[model samples]
Target: MNPELKLVAARQGGVFSRAQAMAVGYTPEQIRERLTGGRWERIRHGQYAERADLSALDAWEQHIVRHRRAVHAAMNSMRPGSAVVSHHSALVLQGIPVWQVDLAEVQLTRTSGRGEVKAGVRHHQGRLSPADTTRVDGLTTTTIARAVVESAARTSFEAAVVSADAALRRPEVSAEDFRRLLAVTECWPGSPAIRSVLAFAVPLAESAGESRLRVLMRNEGLPPPVLQAAFNDAAGFVGRVDFYFPDHNTVVEFDGLKKYADGSREALIREKLREDRLRALGLEVVRVTWADLLQPARTATHIRQAFDRARRTRLAG
Candidate 1:
């Protein structure tokens, strides 16, 4: 590990391109030797990082690596032109939830094409304002807000709603940012549909998990579930519960069955312990599982009964 390469790797947070290494005075052979020695890990064709403490490819990292690859491919495949990664690619990069499936197409906007070009990418060619683009990790990308708008245009009202909600909740993204992005993309191909979906989803994205229980509860006319609610006491901030009704001191937790690895018996014991704590506080607790959520009619009945019981208890006291 030469000082120059170490400095470059540190500056890049242990990720650098072959070109970046060359610029920093490391030969391709040197890079290869380091990789063979287990001193560096190759992330992509040209991207390398430190071998130790490598982060696994979670959902977010998958999106970023895909976006980075697409951008690099686009740069290589196209003529000399600047293209900002747009639409769903931007949404994924911004950590907005659009769907769970793989996006086979990389999206981008440049000035030379009419509709789409390339096999894996859906490219939209049009004039783009400078403000519509920003540099993220040294690659051009649509601003977070524009990506949300573009994503809404490509999906259904429900999907768009989810994207908008996620976008609003993002700390770096704001309504003002969306407004500015909207102003720039309004005259572009999919503006009208984009505008409609953006309006729909941004207000509804309060919860983090995309659980069917959430959808079932919403469809059944329950009040919107507060997301990731935390409990605080003598111990600095107790565990964060899934949903809580502060006014009634009633908590509803959505336990994904898949998370219960040891089996239902152990899960049952854990739930009893959690319930006992809440009961000690004089709080009512309701537990819902994936099965209950799938059966919406039964789920609604359970919720209504719980609400009724809580009301009776409070009134009687």
Candidate 2:
């Protein structure tokens, strides 16, 4: 690869157009040879990326990386300022994690044209005022608030809440920002769902797993638990819990892989000790993992059993 072309590709998320390769002293035949040799992979029509970059990512991460490169490719091929990245695509560019949202097609909002889907790109025809649009990674994109609302309008409630919760955690985004966008889009389709997401989204959620767990609790008819509640004992600060059910005297902790990413025995022992201390305070503890979230009914039953145990212990005391 030419040095100039590598620079260009680096600036565009490791994607380069065919014309860019040609300008960087590569012939059409050579480009084809590189693609065939697996040195370069095609992202979209006439868009190519280094095979090494794609192969370096894990399967799940590769999807997002490919979609991001595709977004850059799609935007580069379009007329400048003609459209802004919107919806899930905008969230992607803004670096907010999305859950269960389709990324097969890059979504854009045309400033002045009818909506259409062409070549894996979905052009949305909607009003995008200056206030609602911003630049992200050198590409024009919808503001985080608008992206969240637009995304909520089109995706499942769980997916929407995940993105919304993540967005609210950003310093640039606030609950008020979402509310303002919600007010403006009140009559828009899926406004009711967006409203529900706004009402439920909290900044304290630190991971997508936690957000999904919250949605599951709501859908399973569990009473709302306090978020990130702090616990302490006479020794010192115990730890902050993910969810605390005050009335039930139980605490639910989301056990995602990141919690134990180090795979250290000492870390596990520390966590066990923390649970012991919480139990010493007469608080029943329940653990929720990604797998447990998948089995919502069983998870709810387990939580209920913990609540019953706490009640029984109190009675015995």
lDDT for each of the candidates? Answer: 0.66, 0.91
User: How many residue pairs of model 1 clash at the backbone?
Assistant: 3
Summarize candidate 1's per-residue lDDT along 112-177 as a digit string, tens digits.
Answer: 656765567677765667767776654567777777777766665555666677777778777787
Q: Give the clashing residue pairs of candidate 1, or none.
A: 161-201, 164-202, 165-201
lDDT of 2: 0.91
Q: Candidate 1's error at 55, in angstroms? A: 13
Candidate 1: worst-modelled 10 consecutive residues by lDDT: 202-211
Candidates in order, TM-scores: namely 0.63, 0.96
Positional deviation of residue 265's Cα in model 2 after best superposition, in angstroms: 0.9
Which pairs of residues have clashing backbones in candidate 2? none
Ten-residue region with minimum lDDT total, candidate 2: 52-61
lDDT of 2 at 148: 93
Q: How far is candidate 1 from the true structure (C-alpha RMSD, Å)?
A: 6.3
TM-score of 2: 0.96
Q: What are the per-residue Cα lDDT tens digits for candidate 2 across 254-292?
A: 998675887999889999999999999999999888899
Candidate 1 ranges beyond 4 A from true positions: 1-68, 94-98, 182-216, 225-241, 245-249, 256-275, 280-283, 287-301
